[model samples]
Target: MYKLLVIEDDVMMSDMLSMYMSGEGYEIKQAENGEQGLKLLEQFVPDVVLLDLMLPDWDGTELCIRMRQHSTVPIMIVSMKSEVSERVQALRAGADDYLCKPFSMHELSARVEALIRRARLMQPNAAGGQQEEAGQASEKEIKLDSERRLLLVRGTFVETTFSEFEIMKLFLTHPGKVFSREDLINAIRGFDSFVTDRAIDVHIVNLRRKVEKNPKEPHYIRTVWGVGYKYVTEVEATR
Candidate 1:
C-alpha cells in the first residue's frame, strides 16, 4: 500500500484530508504541528508528504528546507496562501509540487500518486542482473541532481536541460525499468503541462545526440525495440 503523511495545523482540514485520502486506499498519517510531523517522519518513511505552509509551531518552508537536508521524498505543498512569492519560496526550498487550498481531494490524490510514480523511476540503471532498492533511488538523486540537470553517468559529468536530466536520472536510477513513451512523459510532467509523447521522443533524440559516443549509432541510450529507452550502464564495460 502507498503511504502518505499529511502535515496540516487546521484540525478540520487535516482530518478531512486523512479521511479522503484513506478512502482512496492510501495509508494516511497525520501531524498537527511541524514538530510532531517531523517526529512522525522519523518512524514513518512515507512515499509522499502533503504539507501546509502555515503552522502554529514552525513554518512549512523551514521544514521543507530541513527535509531536503536528509531526504529526497517527494513533497507536495497544499497551502491557503496563494501568493506567487510564497509558492516560489516553497519550491526553492525543495518542495516538488504546490497546490493551493480548496483543491479537490481527487486532485490531491492525483498529485500524490504522480509523485510516488516519478520517485520510483529512480532505480534500475544497472544494465544486467543486479538492481537496487526503492530507497536507494533517493540516495542516487542527491548526487544526480536531476532538478539541476546534472548527471553522473559512470562518473562522468554531463550537463543537460532539466527535462533531459530528469529523463536521464530516471533511466540511470533504475537501470532496466522499461518505460513506454506515455510513462516517461507522465513521469516528467510534474507542474508543467506542456509535454507530449512526441516531446518525449524528441528529448530522447536530443539526449542521444549529446551523451552517446556515436549519436548516429548510439550505445548507452538504447531503444527497447518496441517499448521505449533505457540507459545501458553496462555499455561502458562492454565497449
Candidate 2:
C-alpha cells in the first residue's frame, strides 16, 4: 500500500481525505499543522504529501520548500486559495501539484496513484538498473542540477522551488517546444488539477524574474503569442 501524509488544518477535510484515501488502500497519516507534519516525516517517510496552504503555525509553501530540501516525495497542494497568484506562489514554493478546494475525492485518489507510479518508475532498481537522464541541448551558461534541484545562472546558483525546478527541467530539456498553459499545468500537476491558465502566466513571470536578464523581454522563456510558451536555447538568444 502507498503511504500518504496529509497536512491539513481543517478537521473535517482532513478526516474526509484520510477516510477516503484509506478506503482506496493507502496508509493514511494526518497532521493538523506544518510542525506536526515535519515531525511525522521523521517518523515515517511518505510516498506522497497532501499539504494545505493555510496552517495555524506555518506557511504551506515554506513547508514544501523545506520538505523538498531532503526528500523528492511527491507533494500535492490541496488548498482553498484558487487565485492565479496563489497557485503560482505555491508552485514556486516547491509543490509538485495543486488541487483547489472542493475537488473530487476520486480525482485526488487518481493523482496520488499517478505520483506513486511515477516515483516507482524513476527509482533505481535493486538489480542495478538505472533510469536514463535527460541531457541539455544547449551550451548556455545556465544550468539546472536535477539532483540538487538548483538553477545556476552564469555560475551563480539560484534557488528554486520543486515546481519551478520541474517547469524549468521540462523547458530546458526540450528547448524550442511550445508548452501550452494546459500542457504545463498537466505536466507539473495532473490533468485533473484545477489551476487556472493565468497561473501558468504567473509562474512564467516569476521564473523570468529569477533567470532572465530582462523580465520585460524574456530570452530563456518566451511567449509564443496566442499559443503558449517556449524555451529559447540559442547562444545569442539573450539580450
After superposition on all C-alphas, the RMSD of every candidate to the true structure, in Å, is 5.5, 6.2
Predicted structure with the largest lDDT when compared to the true one: 2
> Per-residue lDDT of 37-128 in model 1, one digit per residue for the tens?
88777779888999999989888999988777777788999998888788768866778888998888888888888788767744333322
Tens-digit lDDT string for candidate 2 (21-119): 999998989999999999887787999999998999989888988887878788899988888787777766666678988999998988888788766
Off by over 4 Å in 2: 125-143, 146-148, 152-164, 167-186, 189-239
Candidate 1 global Cα RMSD? 5.5
How far residue 172's Cα lies from its native spot in candidate 1, in Å, is 1.9
